[model samples]
Each structure stands twice: as C-alpha cells, then as structure tokens.
Target: MTLSEKILARASGRDQVRPGEIVTCKVDLAMMHDSGGPRRVAPYLERLGAKIWDPSKVVIASDHFVPPPDVDSAEILALTRRFAREHEIESFYDMQGICHVVLQEHAHVLPGMFAVGGDSHSPSGGAVGAFMVGIGATEMAGVLVTGEIWVRVPESWLIEWHGQLGEGLAAKDIMLFLCAKLGMSNDYKVMQYAGSAVTALSMMERLVLCNMSAELGAKTGIIAPDAWTLAALREGGHEVGDDALRWQSDAGARYERHLEFDAGALAPQVAAPHSPANSAPVAEHGGVRIDQAYIGACTGAKLSDLHMAASVLKGRKVAKGVRLLIAPASTLTTREAAADGTLATLVEAGAIMLPSGCGACAGYGAGVLADGDVCIASTARNFKGRMGSPGALVYLASPYTVAASAVRGTIGDPRDLLAMKAAA
Candidate 1:
C-alpha cells in the first residue's frame, strides 16, 4: 500500500485497506478557523447535545478575517471564541495566524496521523506525512461528536521529481508547472511525491508542494517521512521515535498512475488569470504591468518565501505605481521575520507589511484591487474575482517572481534580477 493508504488503514484499525473502500477512522486532529467554525458550532451542539468528544484534539484558529473587516465578521469571531471557551478547547488560537501554519508551528500534526480540517487546503499538514484531508461543515460536526469520520480511500499517483532545481525557481513554480501539464483531473486520488528532488526540499517547501494539491483536484498530497522530515519534526519540538520513520510506502506498493520530472531544466512558472492550470514560463509574460504584488497566504507566506522575496527586493524599491504587500503566514513567522530584519528590509524597499493572516488573499483585510487592475501575487488560487473586483486580474507566481515583478513594475523574471544583482 501507499504511505497514505497505510496511515489510513492503521487509523481505521485495519491491517490493510484498498482504494475505493469506505472506512471510519479515529481522527488524530480536527481543526476549524473563523470562516467555518462559527457555522459548525451550532451544528456540533445540535448533533452532540453539549460536550465535544475531545477538546485536546480540536484546534480553532481565528484566521480568514483576523481583525474582522466588519461588524459581521467580528460577530462571527466572537461566536467562535465563545464556542471554544464553552467547550474548553485548549488549542484555540485567536488571531495567531492561518490555521494550517498555526497547526504546523504548534507541532500538533505528526506522521502516521489522520487529521482533518474545515478548509480545502487542510491537506497542507501532509508535508509531515500525516494523512490529512478536508471535510465539509457537516462532516466536521460529525467528527466533533464522535471523533471519527468516514472517508473513501483514494488511489495514489506517484510523482517522482529528480535533479536540482534551477536558481530563482521554487516549489511553487514546480507545482504550477505540474498543474499546467496535468490539468487537474485527479479526483479521489492522492499525489504522492518522491525521488531525490522532493527529498531535497525544505519542510516549508514541501508544505508548499502539498498545499497546492487542492488546485489539482486531488484528495491530498503527501510525502514519506524521512531523515529530513524527522529533523524538521524535531526542530518543531516534536519528539520522534524510531517507529515514526517507519511510515513509508511499501517496496511493491501499487499506484494508479506514475509521472516523472527533472527539476533542473524547469523555469519559474506563472498561472494566468482565472485558472491555476493556465500557466507559462515567467519570460513568456514579461513586460505585463501589475498594480499590486502580494505575498501572503498559507501557501506563500512562510519565512523561506519571505527570505526569497527579500533577496530580490534587498536594495531596490517597488515600482512607482506598484504596491507591494507582505503578509506573513503566522505571528510566529511575523516575529521571526521582524527579529531577522526581513520585515525591515522589505519595508525599506517600500513594501507594506500587514498583520499575519490570510490578508488580501481572501479579499477581506487588505490590498483589494480595483476593476481593471492587474496583480502579481504569490498567494494560491487565481480564480475569477478571488481578490475583489471581478474585472481585476490576478497572476500567481513564486515569491521570487513576484518580488522581481514588484521591483520592475511588470511580470519580470527573478533570474534577471539575480543577474543584475550579481553584476552589481
């Protein structure tokens, strides 16, 4: 069986399980944020009639609308807070960060665990080899009542990536490239990343790789736990045992499909307006002007992402008409960036730093674009009207590409900036 299959089988108390089988499994962690928690609270009470099944296993984060853009959003957050307090949920995080990043930083997700969240991108936890999946409000309420939920085991696709990534390219570019090639048809199937290139990615990079699997219409994305994954787990304060490293795909595991790529020859990629699969190399869209350059969201606001953006904007300023917005993924990341002067350098380069939350990515808090405006953003998803106005256009790219475009006032390539920096 695949690693996801093995983890789900173990959680369901089965020796073995196969694709297309329905199984009820005990949930290791269940999470919800402001966007879904308020609506779920009433259903949970209606279904369970008072007490939650497990408070320790539940995580509630006040993200999506951190400061509450309006009175309605504020009321929603207040109700969510009330629910957490009434249930005595110890993992409640108020204005801490995005829910996924908060869980990652808090060390709640572990290898071989079956986790679920209310958001579609909840699969981000799969970076640590956890069998994480997203559920609807009704399903989440069921989990809140019984600590168990039924899931259909998904077939697995082996996506092996080898060779070193080129300079100025990132995991986001690779995902975009794959999305363009594969065209998002993997319903009820998992994308299992492997090979040397994948293993060489940092934990945060791996998280980016898995987080975007939602764009591909996948059940989830996962990687086998390895020495690097163990090191990251340790660094995040998780105590790793020998058994944790045993979570790997079997030698003769069956997969529905297999694909391979050489990362060394890939170029930085961008997704055009309205579709993640509508992608092209950065150089192909050069000279396209943008009004805003945004860097934030669960997918794009990690410290490494910020560092990459900072590298490009170090001694430069955002173009005269371009507004660069930087939102860190979490408060912890915000503190780290501030302490390390990443925030300062970005600010010195004329970038506006906002509180760590979903920010403009959700089209609520900050940097909303007007009609006819064009934005080059590092945030995931570029669907129509994702930012604010339906007439506005959004282009998704890596942090390096976004930063370079911010400086040049157009969709620019990071390698061009790198070459100029080197020549200087």
Candidate 2:
C-alpha cells in the first residue's frame, strides 16, 4: 500500500487495506478548544454516564477566548480548567495561542497518526504527515469514550500545480483561487495537491493550503510525506519513524478527478463579497475597497508572513480610514518576532498588535465588523457573517496584498507596490 493507503489502513484498523474499503480505527490523539470542548465534553459526560476512557491522549486548550473577552467566556474557561483537572488530561494548553498552532508547537502531534478535533482546522496536523480529521461534538464524544473513529476512504482528487507563482503570490492566494474556481457548494469532495508547485512550498505553506480545505468542504486535505515534511516534524519535536515516513501515488494511481493548475499564469486572487469561493483577479476587480485590513490568523501568522507584512508597512502608515490587526500564531512566534523587531515594524506602521490567539478571525472576541463594513483579511473562511454582522463584507487575499491594501485603504495589489518600491 502507498503511504496514503497505509495511513488510511492504520486509521481504519485494517491489517491490509485496499482503496475504497470502509473501516474503523482507534484514535491516537483527540483535541478540543474552549468554545467547543466544554460543550462537547459536557454532553459526553452526560451521554457516557462515566469518566473519559483515557485522559492522557486527550488535549484541550482555551485559545479561542484567551484573555476571555467577556464574563461568559471567563466562565467557560473556568469550566474547561475544572474538567481538565478532574479528567487528569496530560496535555492542556491555556488560552495562550491558536489551538492548531499550539498543537504542533507544544502538543507534538505526529504523522501516520490519526488525530481528530472538534474544530474544522484540526487537519492542520496533516502537515506533519498525520491523517487528521475534523468532526462535530457528538463524534468527539464517541472518541473520548472509545478512542476510536469510523471513516470511509474518500475518493481522491489530484490537483497538480506547476510553475512558479509570480511576485506577491502566496499560498493563501492559491486557496482563494481554487475556492472560487471550484465553487464552494460543490467542493466538498476530497482534494490533494501535488506537482512541482506542491514540492516547492515550505511546510507552513503546505499547512496553509491544507488548512483551508475545510472552506471548500473537503473531508480533510493531505500531502504525501516528503523530506521537507520530515524536517518540519523534527523541528516540532516529533520523531519520524522509518515506516511512518511514506508517500502515496504508485504508477497509474487512480484518482476520482485530476485538475491542473498553472501557478505562473495565476494572478493573486481575492475571494470577494461574503463567500470565499466568489473570487476575482485582484486587478480585474479594480478594488473592492476595505475599511479594515488584517494580516494575521492560523493561515498567515507564521514568521515569514510577519516578515512580508512588516516589509510592506516598513516606511508607510496604514492608509486613512483603514485599520489593520496583526496577531502572532503562538507565544514562541510572538517572542521571535519581537526580538527580530518585526513586531516593532508592524506597530510603527500603525497596525494594532493583538494577543497571540484566534481573536477577531473567529469572531469570538474583538475586530468584529459593523453592518456594511468591508474588510480584507488573511484568515481562513470568508463565509457570510464569519467575522461579524452578515451585512458586513469580507475579501480574502494574501498577506502581502493585505498589507498593501492597508497602506492604501483600498483593494490594492501587492505586485504594484513591489514594483513602485523597487523603482523608488
């Protein structure tokens, strides 16, 4: 079996598996956040009529409402702590960072392992070569008791991206591009990315890509194991096993569908309006006009993304009427950016630095938009009312483009800024 097949087999608990077989496997790790964990686990206790089967394998964090924004949130955090203490769950992260980011940094979730979480972005662990899935609360309860899950091997779809993405293009742009091209309503099918472009991206980039598959309604997105992936795992303190380091797609590997993407020809894309799939080329749209610009989230909070935002805002202020909110991915990332003066650069440009948490992106705390407001953001998901009032509009773009737009207070293209800056 290929690596993908092997992973599916292991997760499904089958001795030998072929494509298209349905099976059930025990979950190696289970994670939850404050918002969902309390609700999910509370009901589980009620349903199970007993304590959790094992607490060590379960990890819970309150990153969503970290620094709890309201009285209600504080109560939720209090309950989460109570439950964690009672369950003796070995791993519990406070509201210090994004759940997905902390999962890799402190939790050491690994590849060839099956992990499930209440949050849709749990597949972020796939970057470390794990077969991760995101499910609802009830599903999580079952895992909490049995430590096992049932899965149907999804029919795979191969998406090949070739050539170099032109200047100012980033992984987020590719996701917006695909989301629009594929149509959100019909993209729930399984999606996998490969080809030269996939090999060219860094681990963070791959994570950014797979992270957004949920926006397209995919079961979970994954990239075949490779050396870059292995090195990234090592950096995160996950030891790679010989058999665990694997790849998929044998000769004549069957795919439900095959789509080719030309990275070079693809311009930076923006998912306009309320839906991420309603995309248009940055230039073609003239400018969607934004009252606020955001440069942080699980998708764009990495060190490289910070560097990109800082460079664009280095000597310029955020344009009149536009506000940019920047949040680092983790406490470690915050420290690294501050030490390198990247955080200073962002603040110097008039961008507001929030705590190292999900914050506004998930609409749990600050940064909510008012009715009729327009925002250009780098976070995942642009579904209607995702950020705040449904009347508000959001356009999804790359970090560079987001920075550039903040500098201009409109939907400006980053390539144009780069060209003008180079000439100056």
Candidate 3:
C-alpha cells in the first residue's frame, strides 16, 4: 500500500489491514488560517497547557482575512498573530497567498505525508502525493493538541485519462468533467489519477484538479508523484536529494471503482448554473447569458492562467452588460503579473483590478453578487450564497472561458475568442 493508502486505512480505524482492508491514519501536518486558527488553537492550548508538541509540524497562514478586511477579520488576525508568536512556530506563511497555494508555492508539503487544514481545499497537497484532508474547527483543535488526527481511509477510485489536452482546456476542466461524470453522490470517495494525461499536466495544474475535488465530495484526489512534481518542488525551494519521484499503483492495486476519460475528445468544459458537477462541453452552454465574469482565484490565479486571460482579452473590452473582476491569487502573483505587464493588459481590456486573497470566493467582502445576478467564476465552489445572495447564479469555468465570457457577456469558449482576436 502507498502512503495515502496506509493513512486512509489507519484513519478509518480498521484493524489487521491487508491489501483491501480499511483503517485510520494519523495526520502528519496540520494547517489553519487566521479565521479559524485562533479558535482551533485556543482549545488545544487550553487542554495542553499552551505548549504545542511540535511547532514545525503545525502551520498557520493569515490568509482567510488578513490585514483586516473588517473589524471581525482584524480581530481574527490579531489573535492568530498572538498564537503564532506564543508557539514560536517556524513554518508559518504569513501575509502570503491563499493557504493552499502558499503551501504548494513554499514547498511545505511533501510526498508520502499526511496533512489536514481548516480549509476545504487542504487536499490541494494531495497533488504532490500526500494524503491531505480538511476538517472543521473543533477537529483542527484536537489536532493541534494531540498533533494527530484520524480519518476514514476511503476505498480508492482509479481515474485514467490519456492524450494531450487541447487548447483552452485546463486541469480544472478535467475535474469538472469528472465530477459531472461521477455524479455528486460520489463525494467522500478517494480519487486517484493515473495514465498519460496525468503525467502530462504540470504540478500547478494538477493541484487545481485535486483541490477542487472537494466539490465532487471526494475525500481527496491525488496523482502519483513524478518528475514534473519533483521539478515543481525544486522550483518551490525543496531539495529532494534524488529519491525516486515515482508513485505508481501496486501491480494489482485494488480500487473499489474506476473511471476513464479520453483527453483527446474532451473540450473546454463548463459547469452550469449552481453546481460544479453539472458540467457540459463549453459549446453546449456557451450562449447562456452572464452578468459577471471572474478570472482569478486560488484555483485559477496562476501566471499561465493570467497569460491565457490576457491573450483572450487583449485589445478587447468587457461586454456592456458584463462586469469582469480580475484578482491575482496572491500578492506575489499580483506582483508577478505587474512585472510581466499582464496586469496592464487585463486592465486595458476593461477588467477591474482587486487586491489578492480569497476575494469573492470567500463570499463576505468583495465582489458579492445580488439576487438574480449571473456570474461565471474560477472559484472553487458555486454553492448557494457562496458569494452573496443565494439567488445569484455562479457558473464555474476555467480562466480561459471566464475571459471569453467577459468579452461576450455570455458563456463563451476561449478558443472562439482567440480565433476572433487573431482575425481582428
């Protein structure tokens, strides 16, 4: 069994595990954001006399609402800052990108490890071949005190895709297409990706796929660690010392289920009104009306995504009835965009620039939608009230599609816009 398999088995509390048995596993690393960090760590400190077992294994990022987006957020950051100072924690990524992105960018996650965070997308680390899970505040508190958390080792589902991804399609589309095919009911199952397509994607792209697997209700999604993953880690400042970067299934790896997608046939995907799982080919719903388009989030805030957006929006303006909000995933991403002139291109195309952070995806402060408004976004979830009034509709699409819709004022494919731009 792999590390993921071992952790899931132990976490599930099964005894005498074999090739097919389930068990519960101990968490290796734990993370929390400012919003939940104070509350979660407070309990743990109270129980353990304010002395954490290991500050190195615990990480706290002030991302949920740092720099005080509001009074409430200000208070949260203060308390979180106090906690970090008191613990002498060394692994903190303060004033950085969104927690998931920051973790990956800083190389805080490693293969064959187990991690849990207060945020839903902790599974983002699973892209690096770790067993990552998300927990509620109380559960996180327990982890802080005990330095360990348990989880049910879910049965694995093998998902394989092959061939090169076409233009305008991204790793995010792969997730949407799978969730739509697997159905929402499959949530909480472990999803493992393999085959040629998995190998073809970059580490950042793979992270986008696994990070959003939560929308499918998946326990976690992971890819076998490979050279591409190792290269990413090295670039992110990790020195692996040449340990094999291979994470392959056992010769007879057992999975409770299976799925297959043909990479060659997959078009850029769109998740229509309200559900990430309600997906279709972009063309199937390309003409649907839209009022707003967002081209940034933790999932879609990469430089490549921004470059893709800029390419589509260059020399073009957002449609009259549509509002486009362009937020980089982090201050660092924003800086990179500015340095590369992508920010200028986006602004020139009539996109409104906003400070980096969770932004509208967090749903409280910025870019809140009104009743009956329709938005196409790159955020993780489109649940009711996720970004404002429950009645506002959010369609999840890749940054490419979001950029296209910004120009068209409707759901449009990026390839179409690229062709149009070239012709113009």
Candidate 4:
C-alpha cells in the first residue's frame, strides 16, 4: 500500500484498504480558524446539543478576520474565544498565527495521524507525514461531535523531482510548474512528492509543496518520513520516536501515476490571475507591472520564506510606486526573522510589516488590493477576488520572485537579481 493508504488503513482499524474503498477513521486531530470554527459550527453543535468528543484533540486559531476591523469581525473573534473556553480547548492559538502553521508549530499533528482541518491547506500537515485533509464547516461540526469521519481512499501520484534546484528557485516554483502541467481538477487523488530535490528541501520548503497541493485540486499531499521529518518533529517537542519512519510508502506501493521532473531544468514560475494553472516561466511574464508586492499567508511567510525574500531585498529598495506588505506566517516567525535581521532587511527595503495572519491571502486582515491594482504575491492562489476587487490582477510567485519583482515594479526573474548580486 502507498503511504496514504497505509495511514487510512491504520486509522480505520483495517489491515489494508484499496483505492475507492470507503472507510470510517477516527480523527487524530481537528483544527479550525476563527472564520470557520465556532462561529460557523457553533449553531449546528447547539442545534444538536453535542459536546466535542475530545477537547484536547481540537486546535483552533484566530487567523482570518483577526484584529477585527469591524463590529461583525470582532463578534466572530469573541465567539471563537468564548467557544474555546467553554470547551476547554487548550490548543487554541488566538492571534498568534494561521491555523495550519500554528498547529504544526505546536506539534499538535504527528506522523501517521489522520487529521482534518477547516481550512483547505490542512494538507500542510502531510509534510510531517500525517494524512490530513480539509472538510467544510458542516462536516467539521460532525467531526467535533463524533471524532470520526468517512473517507474514500484516494489514488496516489508519485511526483519525483530529481537533480538540483537552480538558484532563486524553491518548492513554490516546483508546485507552480506542476499546477500548469497538471491542471487543478484532480479529485480523489493524493500528490506524494519524492526524489533527491524534494528530500533535500528544508522541512518548511517541503511544507510548501504539501500546502499548495490543494491548488492542484488534490485531496491532500504527503512526503515519506525521513531523518529531517523526524528531526523537525523532535524539535517541535514531539517524540514520535523511530517508529514513525514506518509510515513511509512501501517498496511496492501502488500508485495510480508516477511522474518525474528535472529540477535542474526548472525555472522560476509565476501563475497569472484567476488561476494557478496559468503558470509559466517567469521570463514569459517579464515587464507586467505590479502595484503591490505581498509576502504573507501560511504558504509564503514562514521564517524560511521571509529569509528568501530578504535575501533578494537586502540593500535594495522596493520600486517607488510599489507597496511591499509582509505578514509573517506567525508571530513566532516574526520574532525569529527579527532576531536574524531578516525583518530589518525587508523593512529597510520599504516593506510594511502587517500583523501575522491570513491577511491579503484570504482577502482579510490587511493589504487587500484596491480596484485596478496589480499585485504579485507569494500566496498559494491567485483566483479572482481572492485578495481584493475582481478588477484587480493578482499574480502568484515565490518569495524570491515576489521580492525581486517588487524591486523591478514588474514581473522579473529572481535569478537575474541574484546573479547581479553575486557579481557585485
């Protein structure tokens, strides 16, 4: 069986399972944010008068709509707080970070666990070798009450990214390249990344691949547990032990498809407005002017991601007309970046640091584009009205490309800037 199949089989108390088989699995954890947590599921839980099956297994964060800008937003946060207290949810992370980042930062999700989140990027947990997926508010309410949910086993796709990634490239570029090659309509499919380039990536970089799997329309994404995965888990205070390595895909694991790519030949990629599938080489989009350059969201503003942007922006200034807004993935990221001077580099280069939250990525918190604005962001999606007015254009790129483009005030390749910096 594949790693995903093995996880499902274990979670469901089955010896083994096949693709398309429906199985009822006990959820190891359920995560939610202010936008989709208590406010949306509370009424339903009340209607049924059901208590959470296990409060300790639940994690909540106030990310979207945090630091409320309006009365309604404030009330939602209030309700989120009230619900957390009422249920004695000890894992609630309010205004500290996005739901996905907060959960993993606290090591709430572990390898071989079957987890579900209210946010689509829940698959980010798979970076740690967990089988995690997103469910809607209604379904999440059920998980909260019963601690169990049904899932149809999904076919696995093995994407092997071999060789070495070029300078200024990252896991985001690899994902955008895949988004174009594999259009975002993959239902009931799991994207499991592997090979030299993928395994060589930092855990945060690996998380980017899994986090963006949702953009491919995949059910979830995963990577086999390795020394790096175990080390990261241990650093986060999880003693998964050597036994967690058993969660890997078997030698003869069954996968519906196995695709391979040469990381050396890959270029920085950018996705055009309204669709991540519109991705192409950064060189193809050169000279497309942008009004704003944003680095935020769980996918893009992690500590490593901030360092990526700072590497490009150091000693350089953002274009005069461009607004560079950065909201670190979490407050913890902000502190880490600040300690290492990455935050200073960004602010010195004209970045305006917004509070750590979903921010413009969710079209909430701050930095939402105005009508007619053109922006390049490090967030996962560029769908219409996702970051602001429908009339605004949002291009998606990596932190390297976004920071380089911010300096250029147009879509430009980060490699060019890096090369120049090296020569200087």
Summarize candidate 2's per-residue lDDT along 1-424 as a digit string, tens digits.
Answer: 4445567776776765665667787788889988888655786677669667778888887778778878888888899998888789868888667888878776367767778888988877776667678888888888888878877776667888999888788888888988888876533355778878878888778888778888877777777777777777777776776555545656777777889989999887887877888888888655567899876678878777787787788878999888899888778788889999999999999999888778778887678889999998888877788789999888888888899999988887888787777788
Top-lDDT candidate index: 4
Instruction: Give the TM-score of each candidate.
Output: 0.98, 0.94, 0.93, 0.99
Name the runs in model 3 displaced over 4 angstroms.
Answer: 6-24, 47-50, 244-246, 421-424
Cα RMSD for predicted model 4? 0.8
Instruction: Tell me which residue pairs clash in candidate 2.
Output: 111-129
Model 4 per-residue lDDT tens digits across residues 1-424: 9999999999999999999999999999999999988999999999999999999899999999878999999999999999999999998898998888887788888889999999999999999889999999999999999999999999999999999999999999999999999999998899999999999999889899999999999999999889988888888888778988888898999899999999999999999988999999999999999999999999999998999998899989999999999999999999999899999999999999999899989898799988899999999999999998999999999999999999999999999888888989
Clashing pairs in 1: none
Q: Which scores higher on TM-score, 3 or 4?
A: 4
Q: lDDT (0-100) at residue 330 of candidate 4? A: 93
Local distance difference test scores for all models: 0.90, 0.79, 0.79, 0.94
Lowest-lDDT window of 10 residues in candidate 1? 38-47
TM-score of 1: 0.98
What is the C-alpha lDDT profile of model 3 across 219-268, one tens digit per residue?
Answer: 88888888878888889899975563544556677788777778888888
User: Which 10-residue span in candidate 3 carries the lowest summed lDDT?
Assistant: 15-24
For residues 1-424, write the lDDT of model 1, one tens digit per residue.
8999999999999999999999999999999988877555666676567567889999999988778878888888888888888889888999999998888887788889999999999989999999899888878888888899998999999999999898898999989998899887778989999888899889889988889998899999998888888887788788888689889999999999999999988999989998889989988888999999999999999998999999999999999999999989999998999899999989999998888888789787788889999999998899888889999999999999999999999998899788888899
Evaluate residue 105 in candidate 4 and report its C-alpha lDDT on the 0 to 100 scale: 82
Q: Point out the higher-scoring one by lDDT: 1 or 2.
A: 1
